[model samples]
Target: MHDVVIAGGGPVGLFLAGELALSGCSVLILERDRDLTSPLKALPFGMRGLNAGSAETFHRRGLLEAMLEASGADRKEVGADPDASEAPAPRDVSHFAGMGLDAGGIDASALPFRLPGPAMAGFMTSLEAVSTVLTRWAASLGVEIVRGAPVTAVTQDAGGVTATAGGQEHRGRWLVGCDGGRSAVRELVGFDFVGTDPLFTGYVAKVTFADPRQLPLGFNLTPTGMYLRTSFEGHLGMNDFDGGTFDRSQPLTREHLQAVLRRISGTDVTLTDVELASSFTDRAMQATRYRKGRVLLAGDAAHIHSPLGGQGLNLGIGDAVNLGWKLAATVHGTAPEGLLDTYTDERHPIGAAVLDWSRAQVATMKPGPNAPALRKLVLDLLSTPGGVTHVYRQTSGLFHRYDLGGEQPLIGLSAPDFRFQEGARLGELLRQGRGVLLDFGRDRALQTAAEGWAGRIHYAAGPVRNDLGFTALLIRPDGIVAWADDHADTEAFQRAATRWLGHPRTWAPQVGSGRVE
Candidate 1:
């Protein structure tokens, strides 16, 4: 039986697959779509722009920089140099600062969270770029990516999980459904998807050569939840650029898109060079349950939100990445059953929050009196140092903290970025392919305890700063802290590991001779 089989090959599924494969777990991924070569549409191409947090997550997962560099290198090879092309290279690969347009690189280290940005239209370049790197990375990690294997049915029992796809039957110790928003595996398993699909249909169009002069100052117009282009550059700065750009407050049609350009910018419009365009509704909702026995759901199958936050795709990927390692450990007989349960605990709350934010964004953009008031308030909030910092924090993905009951040091807290004297920094260390286990390397009690779990863990020496809250942290393969000391406790190490993480001996270590052993 395969250790784990993921139902989707989208970025999140691919990311999770990579994590599991790298951790030495045998992973099989079944993607319904036949075209494996086709770049996965990780986001709504016409109207999706990533925040800083998305960029940082890619970085932590060792994908952001690699993907950008790779895309640049590919462009150089293919003569599609982002710097030289009529169409810009995808966003992540393109240096936003160099291009004169960016999310106003404000430092947000001091902030608690990042508020999401107003919806804008940007190229689907970042997702594609990240996918390029992820494809290669996942392959390198030994994940068997099976395309056209539409998962038709999924069922789980006490022993393991069984799935049927493309008329083929497969068995695995666990099955993870990383399918898209409308998940087939979730349906097969009868998981109730709870949430409402909103009425606003996001009409997306990637029209090219739409004479630049014909547009208003803003490259993007948010007048009526409608717009053209990402954002305007050249002098208007960010918000002031596209004024007459299709009042986003109104229902948009293909004609509306064309007319807005011609009327505002005094330019003729035609769709000769149009590359891609489509429409999808903005629905803010999530699955009622993330898991039901050995069959589990991750990615879009678990939560589907409006495209406002650009959170849909990244959220899904993060979900899969978080779940993969835990499932893998369980499969390998190293993690406790409780470890698998934390996936829903940690992720559902984030989904609920996204839903709330998307609703606010939608309400703020509607065509009504509230629009102007909300617009001013939002702009005011976005422009403030505090507001900007909030946006930055959310975008950076650094603010995400797991619930460790205020007891586990690094377990619940995000390990802040730090410069290291050794070969790698904190991110680089965690990026080395698996979750890290930072051993004081000097504490005898800790060392002795670690020695017993030698086969599945890695050791590291940390004179790790004391206030970071974790001394002996057991970081999961997905870079989440599974266990850590609350206040540098030398003896609580084993209990911490067994309780939070899937440490081998989660059950009581049979009171050996009624002594501490």
Candidate 2:
């Protein structure tokens, strides 16, 4: 038996394994892929997730530096560097001159912190980056990784959960399914995966750029009702994703490639090296049930959708960070198991929202007389300052906020990714396998309360980010402000903390785990 056994070693499962391992939980990951040690092999421009908030995850876990080292990517290096002399961000689409995506709101500059391990997300990088870094780092912290063992089913009771993997059974105090769209673990637990499936099949092919003039060095063709798109980078800095809907009966062939190049680039530039091409459909579904007995679902198992916003991959990984620590806290008997319930309560709605928006985008992309007009409206909004701000916030994942009620105003807001003058940035401290109290550099009572109960709760202080304002706050492991104190009201702050995390802040029974369950 293990403390936690995760099915599906995709981005979500890999991240969960790392979080659990880092939290000191004895965890094992069962991946169906043949190679256990291979880095995540992804297509050139596979947009992962689009949360500006994801930056917190990448920076906190030190994966930013990991990717920089692995792919030799410079943080300052972007497709559109105003100062680049030779290769530059793409400038135009077919008949659309200088058609470049304005990614001005994003902070492409590198911050401080050298990370103790490796980084994961980036185009031209591997999917295994997230898993490999977590696996190795988690193993160093004593987590185990098992590959090629696809989970066949799961059985659970109040005591624990047992999983059958490729004719073998593994028991654990709790089971987490990070498996992709079709989750065996979810099916075994009797959870209903109710959501929309793709009516059209899509293919993604990563072609090497031997010819520089094929397409401009920028984002997916400004989303103009033009031909298809070129390479688009996810806000997370993963792979470049480019490709579109394909006929279900027809396979992706050179003809399709020719047609795409002809429509967008106005050049019939043939490619010799097609590194990787994957054909899959969209599924905008979420499990009707997130937890059944001791078995729980996360990532793709919990939600799957059209990869329009680069959300599928990143959303799953985000679920890992959110659920892993909650489950570990529950198993350790610190917080109430109720905390785990929050995973579904919080993320399920987010999934639904993404599905709705993604479907709208796919609808807009439909080739028809109105398609051009629809695309024009979107681009017009995107060009405006308000539209640009909203677009970046929505697409970059920075605007993701939860309704988790806490006295701290920042509770639902993205945790302040402030620059730490003396120590590591506030974000880096969170990746230390524990929750961080933003402290906002105020309130002695929190220290007293935390000291009153040592080991279980931890605290750290940093000045608020210039954008966050002048107040002390406490952030959770998932980079959400669990509690914040605007003034020097220690008792009020402690009360808020108690309501948010449950004092002694454990997964104990009876007091509710901050969820409807």
Q: What is candidate 2's TM-score against the reference?
A: 0.78
1-517 in candidate 1: lDDT tens per residue? 8888889887778888777775677889898988755422433352234443444445456665465464343323222232221222222321211112234434334542122211111223445655657777777766788889999877789988999998998898888888887889888988888776464545455555445555453334344333445452311111112322322556544565455444433457554443444445556668777888888888788877666656676577667667766776776677766788788888888777777766666556555546667667676666655666555445434456778564544456455443233434445555544555675434666766766555455556656432243455666556666666534455566665566445554222111110000
Off by over 4 Å in 1: 39-65, 73-125, 208-212, 217-219, 231-275, 407-410, 431-434, 439-441, 462-472, 482-488, 503-517
Instruction: Output the number of the lDDT-best candidate.
Output: 2
Assess the local accuracy of residue 110 in candidate 1 as a C-alpha lDDT between 0 and 100: 55
The models' CA-based lDDT, in order, is 0.58, 0.59
Please give the TM-score that candidate 1 achieves against the real structure: 0.76
lDDT at position 83, candidate 2: 32
**Candidate 2 per-residue C-alpha lDDT over 41-128 given as tens digits, one digit per residue, 9 for 90 to 100:** 5334433322434544766776665544454455553122323222222211111111234655323322111121112112334564
